[model samples]
Target: MPRPICSQCQFLIQQCLCDHLSVVKSDIELVIMQHPSEVGHAKNSVRLLPHLLDKVRIVVGETEQDFAQLKAELEAESRPIYLLYPSEQSVEASQVKHSQQGILIVLDGTWRKALKLLKFNPWLLSFQSLHFSPQAPSRYRIRKASRIDSLSSLEAAAFGLQALQPQMDIKPILSAFDAMIEQQLVHMPEHVQARY
Candidate 1:
């Protein structure tokens, strides 16, 4: 039988994270493009982003139709759209001034899947791209990353939001992220858990 899920947080009852969450209103809107494969993933941080922020829209898929809808939304809004993708052309997140107003699109998926999403959506190439030099190691302990600089979707969003809006408090999001990591660690074999 499936485990009982928490209606509020949507996590299994034993792994519910409602108490750890803190909701905050954001000046910048977040448009998360999630790969279908990430849906219902136990450790998917994208699931927590909408819960933490007041303005978040999740679009799932890489089809032309999906891109069309995203494009329409972008056209409807006057805000400049920025893609949070790391590339040679991407500017440091900190460089994005607070004066800038617009949407931030985050691609949520494995590196390969993220690349596929970009390739499938040619229009996304027009958006400004941003990246961050992580000040600390990623808190995503459950998943092994090919590169040390890699961060989970939530971490990227938190860092990006802080960079764009220096005054915005992101402690709650980070606190909840840490709580999720700690909960995951408890489920691992004691021998496999990292020692601090």
Candidate 2:
């Protein structure tokens, strides 16, 4: 039988992250487009983001049709919509004009899966794209990234939000992320944990 899952964090009851969650409200909206394959991945930080932040929308799918409601909402809103993908055309997040309120769309998946998501959702091409230069390496200890610049969904969101809203306090969200990583570290083998 499947282990009992926490209704709040959706993590196994024994590994529940509910207690570590820190709720933060933001002026800028976040839309996380997660690939369906990441749904059950234990190290997927995207799963923890919504619980910690206000005004976050999590959409699971790889196709335009799957995000119909989100697309409609973006269209209806007067604020600009920006995709947080590091494409050649993307401008650095720090350089984005702060004059307008906007929505930031982040694709939560591996590099290949993220590319697939972009391929399937062509409409996202119309939006302005933004990228960020990480001052430090990703703090995602549980998963191995092929590239040093790669960041987990939560880290990307935190950095993106910090850049978009300089006044926003991201400490709570980052603290919760660290707590989750610490929890996952307990389940890792000694050799694996040593690398972190």
Candidate 3:
């Protein structure tokens, strides 16, 4: 079945409310592995993070060949890689896996999809996973979560980059993300926005 047009904007779901679109400027590189289903999700902010910072890259799709190619490029660089996740098997965000350049791999999708991406891409498991304890609520209203400290893709990049480079002021980026989410929520119907 064709997806319903967004009631408020009359645009296709992919173009309606794009919360995922963000700008990023950071010293650390961010590689987002996004799920196909999350491409249009209003709460997915991976696309937007690169605008806020300068050091961001995004790759969509989940395939062994793609992961292998990414791994080859990353391995050639003299940097440490980290998988940004909140699991018992993860690493702390406070410490850098390597003193050289750091490549942060983030899975931008639902929890289940994220797990699938991680599991399917065994090369990602070789990197130390970075997990954090957030002091704020998530701004992603369209997506439901089992955790209160959940954050949007942009938020994760902002915080992760900040942790890596303490000299940068990442608050403004996060604020912009929040403002964007608020604007999107205001345009959405009360019932849909209420879920946030």
Best by lDDT: 2
As for lDDT, the candidate ahead, 1 or 3, is 1
Model 2 poorest 10 in a row by lDDT: 93-102
Give Cα distance to truth, residue 168, candidate 2, Å.
1.3
Model 1 lDDT tens row, 136-188: 99989888888889899888888888888888899999888888888878877
lDDT for every model?
A: 0.85, 0.88, 0.72
Measured against the true structure, the TM-scores of the candidates, in listed sequence, are 0.92, 0.92, 0.80
lDDT of 3 by residue, 1-196 (tens): 9867756434456455444334445667888888778887755666556556677778888777767777789778777778898888886687664556678888988778888888878877777888877767776666678767777777786787777777778766876666666666777888987677
* Candidate 2 clash pair list: none
TM-score of 2: 0.92
Tell me how many clashing residue pairs each candidate has.
0, 0, 21
Give a tens-digit lDDT track for model 2, residues 13-94: 8778888887898878899999999987888898888888888989998888999888888888889888999989999888
* Segments in model 1 whose C-alpha atoms lie over 4 Å from true places: 98-100, 189-196
Q: Which 10 consecutive positions of candidate 3 have the poorest summed lDDT? A: 15-24
